[model samples]
Target: MTRDHSKTFYFGSRFFPLPQRQAVWAVYAACRVGDDIVDEPGGGPVVLSDWWARVQSALTGRVAFSQAGPHPVDLALGWAAGQFPIPVSAFQELYLGLRMDLEGQVYRDMDDLELYCRRVAGVVGFMIAPICGYSGGDRTLEYALRLGQAMQLTNILRDVGEDLARGRLYLPESLLNEYGVTPAMLEAAEVTPEYCALMRHLTALARTWYAEGRAGIPQLQGSGRLAVTAAARAYEGILDALERNGYDNFRRRASVSGTRKLLMLPQAWWEMKLG
Candidate 1:
């Protein structure tokens, strides 16, 4: 699933030992299922709500589907939760984030946007921290949150045009107003100086978070540190690709090439070893 949906992440996961790699795959698959439902045209509030309920049932061992004996993704995730210290609260918060998407909620400011990012992405970091061998540290969790936000911000920037087509804008309204970039401008796929400036500002913010997140990399144990560092570098590479293209996200999608991803591995290994 990771290979199909996220090659960068799939590449990074290879650094982990078998158990951790499988656990990450399980978690990723479970998250992907929810994401797919929300992204589907026919998926509505009822569908999202039902999906959340089924996830809740699966997490609690209630078994939502008897004949099928539980969803395969959920079964793997349930095992992962038992083996690791997966927090149910994080999953609940993720569901709430999905709810926000279903309601077509718009962010009024950075605070609102950050809240959405935290619920949708930060919680995943928290959930994965224990699996990565980091436990019971507020500092580690804070780093996880920062990294998740950084990655999500990158996603928001990269998908700006795509999201606008869906009648959704992850960028904050206040920022748009401040930059004198209107919704119509974005809707029309305008790439004016003001829009470019706005994107630069957002990209800088993401870079800051990425740096802060990297500062906590040494805190992770075993091969998880290498996996995370690789993932971070690969994701950050997208930001670099965007900048290199003059932030023309509408005309083309920003992506890190496979060769570039391969280049990151050795550096990631060195960083892990040095730390």
Candidate 2:
């Protein structure tokens, strides 16, 4: 599933030992399933509600489907939750975040956008921290949250055009107003100076979070540290790609190449060894 949906993450996961890699795959797959439910054509409130119900059941150890038994995602996640200290409430927050998408939610400012990121992506970091062997406290969790936010911000910037085509805008309204950018401008796929400036601002914000996220890597133990670090570098590389394209995210999706991803592994290993 990771290979099909997210090659960058799949590549990063290879740094982990077998058991940790499998656990990350399960967690990632479960989240991917939830995301697909909203992104899929013909999906709506009924479908999302049903998915939430199934997720709740799965988290409680109940079978989500009678005929099919538990969903494979649910089964994998269920096993992962048992092995790690993943909280049920974190998944609940994730569902709420997905529900926001279904409701056509818009952000008023960075705070509102950050809240959404935290629910949808930050909680994912929290869920995986235990498996990575980080058992510190709020400080450690803060790193995970920052990493998740950085990645989500990168995703938002990369998918601006695609999201606008779907009639959804992840960009905050205030930022748009400040930059004199309008919904019509984005919807029309305009790549004006204003749009570039707006994207540049967002890209800068993402880099800050990425730095903070990377700072927390030293806190992690075992080979998982290398995996997480490599994952961070890979995701951050998307920002570099965006800059290289002159912030023309509407017309060009930014991504790190496979060769670059492979190169990050040795650097990640060096960082892990040093720490």
Instruction: Evaluate all candidate structures by whole-model CA lDDT and list the values in order.
Output: 0.86, 0.85
Model 2 spans > 4 angstroms off:
none
Task: Please provide, for model 1 over 1-275, each residue's C-alpha lDDT reduced to its tens digit, 9 standing for 90 to 100.
Answer: 98899887788888889999998998888888888888877788887788788777666766477685777887888778778877778889999998888889989999999998888887888877888997448998889988988988999899888887777889898999999998778778889999999999999999999998887788888888989999999999999999998998988899999999998788878877887
Q: Which ten residues in a row have the lowest lDDT in candidate 2?
A: 57-66
Q: What is the C-alpha RMSD of each candidate to the true structure, in Å?
A: 1.4, 1.5
TM-score of 2: 0.95
Give the number of the best model, judged by TM-score. 1
Residue lDDT tens for model 2, 138-210: 8988988899989998899999888877888889999999999987788788888998999899999999998
82 Cα displacement, candidate 1 (Å): 1.8
How do the predictions measure up, each by TM-score? 0.96, 0.95
Whole-model lDDT, model 1:
0.86
